[model samples]
Target: MSENLWEHRPESGYVTGTDLAGYRVEAIDGHIGKVDKHTAEADGANIIVDTGVWIFGKEILLPAGCISAVDHPNGTVFLNRTKEDVKGAPEFHRDHHTEAPDYRLTLGDYYSGRVL
Candidate 1:
């Protein structure tokens, strides 16, 4: 039980969008998928990004610590992670929001890729 690596402080917004629900996760690299939902907790946020977002392109998880900022412009919410590392992230599911051990391990593995 430790502090979350990333938190949407009252002073900040973890994810910004013209309309949270309107945001569609366009495929990572010409693929087709969009985030469906997300849940943030002390451990981290479980993002239900469209499974398609895990395509053979960019668009991957952002370790809580790697997040330098969250920007929403032109109806898109953008993250700062590089396209290469993002492409290498483990497969993510948009339906696994229950937060389980395997998910946590996958998340940890995700963080490992954040800074590399």
Candidate 2:
């Protein structure tokens, strides 16, 4: 598979919709948090998880391509990554980072590096 979905879009198997918010997010090791927001655009898609109290209310964005599956019956979104991997991701700043020029590139690089 391609390292990054932005480079070569593929079947990510992630169910996308506006109802994804509030869904529980699960890493390989354990539960991380809940989906605070999501975007399902033609160019790309991702979920912003609000890790309240876990990491001081930090929010992390995970590419939709990284999603392994969605268990609607259980209201959980499963990821192909581990907790440590997500923890090491670049901190998401809803204010200025979203408009930063390097935001997309940084996310691509960080996720691509973990594909192996």
The numbered model that scores best in lDDT is 2
lDDT tens readout by residue for model 2, 1-116: 44444421345445445467888999989989999987777545677899888788899887776677777767788887899899999988878665455887788778878853
Write down the lDDT of every candidate, Cα atoms only: 0.45, 0.75
Residues 1-116, model 1: lDDT tens digits: 11344444332245532233334443223323344554555556534445442464323444344333344464343444454455666655435624456766776656554543
In TM-score terms, candidate 1 sits at: 0.52
On the 0 to 100 scale, the lDDT of residue 96 in model 2 is: 65
Q: Lowest summed-lDDT stretch of 10 residues in model 1?
A: 24-33
Cα lDDT over the full model 2: 0.75
Clash pairs, model 2 backbone? none
lDDT of 1 at 17: 26
